[model samples]
Target: MRRLVLTSLLLAIVVIGLGAYTRLTHAGLGCPDWPTCYGLIDVPETSIQIAAAEQAFPERHVEPAKAWNEMIHRYFAGSLGLLIAVIAFVSIKLRFSKSSKVRYPIFLPLCILGIVTFQAALGMWTVTLKLMPIVVMGHLLGGFTTLCLLFLLYLRINARRINTQGEKLAESQLKKYSSYALIGITILTAQIALGGWTSSNYAAMSCVELPICQGDWLSDLSFEQSFDLIPPNQESYEFGHLAHNERVTIHVSHRFGAIITGAFLAWLAITIFLKAKTPSIKNTATILLSLLVIQISLGVSNIWFSLPLKVAVAHNLVAAGLMLSLIALTYKLRQNSEESLYE
Candidate 1:
């Protein structure tokens, strides 16, 4: 079960990276259909197949490269969903089995299964709705949530093995920083959502300049349209429907969100590092700090390098990494707190 969970977790990361790649490459609508590419199981490769695909979905021509990208993401995401189901089944079986001594986490696995199910729905919506910003953002957040939950499940499953070597922190110390860690997670989540919104709306490149947006962005701010969940009616939201000003508003807002999130997480990491008595706790904090820095650097590189495909994908992946590191820190703190309670 542990190995299964770990595999699912790694696959979740791959799904996210592939999703980012698909989005960055303007392949969100590559299939023009859910769970299939132009009514086919795979991309239409043959000339005849391509002709048939184009004939069926005349509005969406067959771009083999883009279609393959979307389909590949779907394939991995589907596999991860199946793996989660197996994890849930194994968890329930273990819970009911009298022969098993280990306390498997039944609820967490079940919850993960539920989330993955919804994530599948979101994935469909992402394509069917023509990359609607809200749906896309929700899908991105869903992926992050699934990743964090899987990491949490892994920590829970290995709690005994993990805590065996590390010196436990005092309950008082744990209490002091747990809330801060939780806040850090919350802030990072919001920031990630903002990033998704920016990307989904094609606003990532709106602000080319560093430190701020272009040409008196303050005067050109259009908050209402930028954050509007439901924009004016359109046949499709592909390539984004927002004006330059609106996109700039979203991009600038994401930039501000990054600054706030980075500052808060940095403070939390440093505080935890200094206050932690256990090497394990301190090491977790150190890793969190390192991820924070890497994430920030990636953010800047996205702007500096004109949002290169590799950098953009790395940005998304590192955000996941940063979130996971924070989860690790929080798990260590909470585990120590519980141990201290019993001690």
Candidate 2:
């Protein structure tokens, strides 16, 4: 089980990295279709084959590198699916075999089983739907959420510094913090979706300042143009044309959200530092502050440098890390408080 958990985490890490790679290579629409590249399961190999496929879609040309990048992402995702399947199988095997992990109260595997299925479907839709900004963002969040949940479970099962119950102070504030964390997760996920949308549409460079978009504290952009689901030009989106106005909209929203999120975290961290006794809480707060600063710095760098691939990817990666860190902190703070009180 330990091995399985470790492998799953690694697989997820690789997939996340691959996803970024696909974005950097501009291969989100490389395959130009889902479950197949140019309508074939495996990517086309030779120019003749590529031409034959391109001939089929005379209007669309499949760049070899772009298709490969997209296909590689799918392969990694497929690999992650295999790990999840194994986890589900072992969970059932452990369930019926009278394992020691299954004591008076059994841990549930059904939730994970359900989530894996949903994630697979969502993954398919991310491509089939031609990387719809909203769906892609949802899928990205779902991926991290899966990883964090698995990590928490692994910590509990391995007894790696995770307590099943709370301390006195942990108990008194459990419910309050739980709600706060949930809210944070919700907001953070939406912000990430906006971030992904901005990147997918090539809009990260649309605005170039922090605490403002286009020189305003509040991003002033045409949401109606930018957020339109369909391309404003009435062209096929897979041809790689997205709503530029929509892209601009996403850029502005994400930038402002980061400012708001960073401000919120600064306040949240100070509050936790003052009100919570756990050193872990203090540490989480500190780490979050650092991440907030790093994220903003990267965001600015992305623009000043004209959306350099490396910095853009780093900015995306940092957002993911921040989201997970907040989730972990929320879980620890709220649950620990509850146990402290209950005990």
At residue 179, what lDDT does model 1 achieve?
Answer: 77
Once fitted onto the true fold, the runs of candidate 1 whose alpha carbons sit more than 4 angstroms away are 166-171, 337-343
- The TM-score that candidate 1 achieves is 0.96
Give the winner by lDDT: 1
Per-model RMSD to reference: 2.0, 4.1
lDDT of 1 by residue, 215-254 (tens): 8889878888789997787789988999999999999899
TM-score per candidate, chains pooled: 0.96, 0.81
Winning model by TM-score? 1
List of clashing residue pairs for candidate 1: none
Output the lDDT of residue 153, model 1. Answer: 89
lDDT of each: 0.88, 0.68
- lDDT, model 2, position 282: 68
